[model samples]
Structures are given as structure tokens and as C-alpha cells.
Target: MKAPPPNILFFLTDNQRNDLLGCAGNPIIKTPNIDRLAASGVRFENAFCTSPICAASRASYLTGTSEKRHRFTFLTSPLQSAYTDISYPATLKMAGYRTGLIGKFGIATNGIVPSLQDEDAVEKMFDVFDNYEHWTEEGYEIRQPDGSVRHLTDITGDKTINFLRTHQSDHPGQPFCLSVSFNAPHAQDNDPRCYIWPATEDHLYAETQIPEPFNAHPDFFRQLPKFLRETESRVRWQKRYATSEDYQRNMRGLYRMVSGVDRNIGRILGTMDQLSLSNNTVIIFASDHGMYYGDRGLSDCWQLNEQSIRIPLIILDPRADENNRGLIREELALNIDIAPTILELANLNVSDKMQGKSLVPLLEKKKVDWRKAFFCEHRFHRADIPKSEGVRTQRWKYIRYYEQQPVYEELYDLRNDPHESFNLAGDHRFSNHLKRLRRRCDKMSAECA
Candidate 1:
């Protein structure tokens, strides 16, 4: 008989920017474990999320499709049954792989939607599902069955370790796909203290000085459209970044939360090694979407800026050739590609309905034609955060706020202006280039829609 497929371990974090990792060039944030994982695996330098919001991007990652196809872009929207039937976890479970999910299952968890809260309806997709939502200031405690209360991150790590140990012991010969999602680094929206980390990590970045991003300059906020300047992003920015002391304290808290997550990752990796499962497992690490920590005078991630769209992507396939390991690919990878890549690694055929292409060729360092550009979108009922769409390529980015009273547009030449400090939409010198990109953007919007 043929050998069973490799076990899959996916680690997902919340509201983490692509640049936060030490391997990604942030000297301040010490993500040594994540850096080591990137060193042992293939890292994609330009991975992006199809949508910048939590629910939408998570849906895309599971279904291998865009928000337009899944129709879960808004807050409290539930994942449709039609797509859940073919989601990565559901399909893998159907194919005889024991599937498990832990931590923030953001999609469809909003209690406002009754159908989404149907336990029996959602639990059928995975063999072991432990769902937890955002932790508030008063509710961050998880009282264990043994009467021990622990930090949410520690509880999450304990549950994950238990799942791994149980999976190995109960089903030694069966392949398993486990997804561990962490809620750290994403601040508690309703709390005044905002970002929270474990007590042990309080001293992680005590002596570090955090530098302000280009977008944090007052001039950047002055240049934004009135609608955007008044959005919730700006509101949160005022709350968290109004003073230098506030900025330093909040930024350090955010980094501390990230380091706490990194420590948990170290524990998980150590457990895998102890179980002798490191060689036969494929580990992938990524974030649901990027976050803006005072970037563009914004504190959240709804805009079409690079800080919101780009995410860190690392894949470690134990079966990879020696030469292929420890390599970095500059290809454009999207969150939608995750499901397809997982299925490909499992030696299963990708569904025709899934729009994302497999990344196996890129992982193998084989020659293949890849996408030149990808589309991003954000839709919301609130008027402050206007519904928007854009197309981003290697050299150019074109965005359109279609819902604004007078349609707002932005054009950036990424090669020359990586920080997007200057907008060239009205410049006569780039009119022809702008026209071509506008046409491409419109075409892609319709195609993706």
C-alpha cells in the first residue's frame, strides 16, 4: 500500500504585520523561533491577503476563494454552508485526515448571527474543534476543568499541545491536519488598556526604543480625504497614539504580545521534536491579515495600504529537497492560495471551484508562470470606512473608493515610493501609466467580482 500523507500543522496569528518578524527586518521585535522556522523553510517575501479584515481573510484562507465569491466581507457575516462543505478542513476530514482547530475561529463566531452559532452545524467540519472568540479585559481568563485560571494564550498553547499529544497517541498511523490560531497582538477593542500580554513577557522590550512609521507623520493625515480622516481607523489612532508616551507604551505592549505568541510557538516546536513528529509534518505560519500600528495615522487594518494587505508567509515541508530548503521566493502569494497548497501537499486534487493555484511548483523551485497582480477589497456598512477595491502589482498600485461622494482614487509607483508617501494620480507625466493601470484595475475588479 502507498504511504500516508504527511501531517499538517498550521499556525495563524491575529493582526500581525508582515514586517514584525526579525527575519522580515524588524530589529525591535525578537521573533527568533519564527525566524528559525523561516530559515528552515521557504519564505514568500510578497504574500498578501485578499481582504484586510479578519472574517473575510479567514474565509478566503479556508475556501481558497475571494470575499466576492464567499460573501462574508461584512462584520458578523457567517460562512456559507455551500463553501463550508468544500472548505480545506471539511475536505481533508472527508479524505480521512483527522482535522483539528483551536483558538480564535473568527469567522461566523459573532453571536448576532443565530445560524453561525449552531454548534452541531459547525462542528461537523472538524474532528476536534475548540473555538474561542476575542478576549476582553474582564474575560481574558480561561478557567480550566481542574480549577486553574490561566492567560488566554497559555490556555491556547496548552490546548494545542494536548491536541497534538492526543492525536499522536490515539491515531498513531493516521495523518492529521491541525490549525492553531492565536488571539494575541490584537488589542481588546473595548478595553482602555488595549494590547495585553502575559506577565512573564513584561520585560521583553523594556529597553527598546520604537521608531515611528512614515505614515505617522501629521502631514500624511492632513493629506487624506475627509471621509478617511474621520474613519474609525483615525479614531483609534487618536486613542492609542495621541502622545509620545502613549505611543511607546502601546507599541511595547503590542510587541510584548507578539513575543508571547513567539514563546508559545517555541513550545509547540519543542513538543513536535519531542514526539519525533518533526520530520513527517509540514508546518506553515501566516497571519489572518496585516495590522497598522499608527501607520497612515491609522490604528486598524481596513485600508488598501501595503501595511494592511501584506502578510508573512512561511512554509516548511519536511519532504523538500535539501537545495530547495531555506530559500526565499519573491512571487506574489495570496491568502487564497493557502487551501490549495495544503490540499496539494496532501496529494489530493484541488477543486475546480477553488480559484487559488497551488504553490507546489514555487516551493519546489520549479519554473512556472505566476500572477503579475492581485486584487484586494474591503466592504463595510459604516460610511466612515468606505467600500473600496484596488489592484496591486510589482511596480504599481491603483485604488478606488467607489462609495465616496466624489469618487476618491490613489496611484502609487511602488518601485520609487515603497512607503506610499506620494500619490501620482493627477501627475501629467504618469497619465498614460495611470490610465493603463486604471483599466487593469477595472477589468480585475469585474473579473474578481
Candidate 2:
């Protein structure tokens, strides 16, 4: 027999990487809360986000489907809600759990929220948590990648803590699903100085000495294929908000952002424990996607490098789930898996329409024959840029483009070329391997479509 469902505490940070924290092996980041969580629960070393853009990636995370299927492919575009079917919160509410969201709701379901169409669903999903309305001042500017200036991490953290305290006293024993989505260190926001970091200007040199990975020459574009280089060149100039010391300064800021977010997580977790919600509540910490902290001469990631799409996913299931409490699953897992996992853990029936498989059984050691590969993609962002997709296996990564008349693609043998500098897509040495990956991506696309 199954134990009663525990409350859900989901934490999400923006533009984060799996390798940025001290627990994940980065000595420079100071993330004690996340480190503590990693020590006590399952740490998925190969977690990947379905996409990199804030809108598309978030849409996938929320709906348990891909961008192409959700049709909310870019930030400003409206979403087609039915394609992905039931959301994590909506499903939980249907199963008798109270639901609430804190911080930024990145995937704005256009003007109307069909999932929240019922009065109960709307109240269950949005009634408890506070977003920018009360969190920010009337005249304060909303941060943008091109011109951002507010210190959002502190504000976001405070607001999240407050929301939890309010609800902590409201429902003493009933089960609930509460999620806090945070924006930190993302490249699209305004200028870079508004966000705080751990290392100051004086300590930058000693701190960021790891140096840029492949494409060692930030100027390696001249050798790239024509259409591919054109997109890379413009992306290079924007600098993705890292302006001072090339990739080094960008990375220093990134490390600062992750460490800062970690501190906030510590605050929220501490409050939960104080309220006695920690022991029974399940805590999940992850990012929308990984960051490109100067890897492959790529400061901002829209690529398939390990540092780009792979992010940190740590699941701290309730005290009683027992099977593999502190285990690490090497299975290839992606973002869509999260929605269904949350649903299944709450004792809700995972909708057949859900493209993701739940992670509960894997946590309980019941899923021995899991998946072999994870599929992801980015579509129609810059009108001039092409649609892109990535396939991640245990040791290989392939990213292809639908840009010109011919498909322009990139393939990397992770064991030999982890930095992903050389494009082996057209190389004769690995044609068979590349073809196999392309076929898998096509099948996933057809399934989602």
C-alpha cells in the first residue's frame, strides 16, 4: 500500500547549469542549502532542459510537452493550451491537493488560462502566492535583458519566504503543492551590474582562471559554415549581458547569480523546517536550463553543449519514500518529466496525453529499465535563425538546424569533444551515429505533434 501524499515544494531558478554549485563540484559557488539537499536526496547528474529560451523552455516544463507541440515557441507568442493537456497544478487540484505558485510565472498562458478556467482551478493555482503585483513597487521597472537594473534575487527570495509563512499558518494539515520560480543570472535581462555576485572585481582574475573551452579562439567563426557563422556572429555581439572581460566576467556574474539563488533556497527551506513542513514535504530544486559559463567560447547558450542544456535536478522526496534516498540516476532525463513526476507523487493519475514519464518509480528503485536518450529543441526565435533540436545520449550530443535549403547541423562525441567545437555532423567518421540520433529526434517530434 502507498503512503499518503506529502506536500510539494518545487523550486526553480532561471538560466542555471548542473555544474555551477559546490556540491556539483564547482569550488567557487557558495550554495549550502542546495549542497545540503544534494547530500540527502537524489541528484540527477544528466538532467537536461527541453529548450534554452525562457518562454519556450518554461512552457515545456509547465505543460509536460515540447515547444513545437505547445506552440508557445517564443516569449511574446500566445500558447495553445490543449496540445500539452493537463498541467502539474491542475492535475494535483483534481486529485484533492491545494496548489499555489510563487515568484515569476514564465509561461503566461496568453490572456486566458484554460486549465485554470474553472473557478476552483484558478483559486487553487493562483490564490495563495504573490507575484510582481505586491512584490514590486508601482513605478519600479521590470527587468529586461537589454536594460535590466533591479536586484531581483533578494526581492524574489523575500517574497517567497513571506508567501510560505502566510500559507504555513493557513492550512496546518492539508496537503498542498507550492512552487517558487525565480529569475537569476539570465542573459536576456537588462544590464549586468544590478545582480550581486560572490567574488568582487579585485578577485576576478584568480577566481575565473579555468579559461574558455573549445573554439579557443572566440574568433573561430571565419572557419564555420556560412549560415551558421552569420547567426553566431550576431549572438556574439549582444554578449548576452556579459560585457566586461569576455567570458570571464560573464562567468563570474553567473557564479554569483547561482550562489545568490542558493542562499535564497536556504532561507525558504529554513522557514519550511521552522514551520515543520520540511520533514514531510517533498523539495525539488532545478533550473529551466543550464548556463554557458564561458564554455566553447559561447557565453550565452542556444546550443547543445553539455554546459548549455544540461541543468541541476535534485529531488528531496519526503522522509519516508526510502528506496534510494541519496542515490544519483544517470538515466537521460529531461524537463517534461517534472510535471508528470509531480502529478504521480501527489497520487494523481498521470494523463495519457502527457509526453513525460514520472520520476517517482526511479526514486523508489522500481524503474530499472528507464530511458536511454532525452530529446529537446528550440524553434523560430529569430526570424532569420533556423529551428534547432538537440539529442543527448550518455556520451554523445547532436544539434541540427533547419536554416537553409539544406540542414546545417552540429554533432559532438562527448568523450572526445566535450566542448563541442568541431562539427562532426558532416564528417564521414560518424555518419551512422549521427543518422541514428536524427531519426530518434524525428520520431519524438512526430509523437509530440
lDDT of each: 0.85, 0.69
Regions of candidate 1 where Cα sits further than 4 Å from its true position: 75-77, 109-121, 143-149
lDDT of 2 by residue, 325-348 (tens): 778887877788999889877777
Lowest lDDT 10-residue stretch of candidate 2: 132-141
Local lDDT at 160 for model 2: 74
Worst 10 residues of 1 by lDDT: 109-118
Per-candidate TM-scores read 0.96, 0.85
Quote the RMSD, in angstroms, for model 1.
1.9
Give the clashing residue pairs of candidate 1, or none: none
What are the candidates' C-alpha RMSDs? Answer: 1.9, 4.6
**TM-score of structure candidate 2:** 0.85
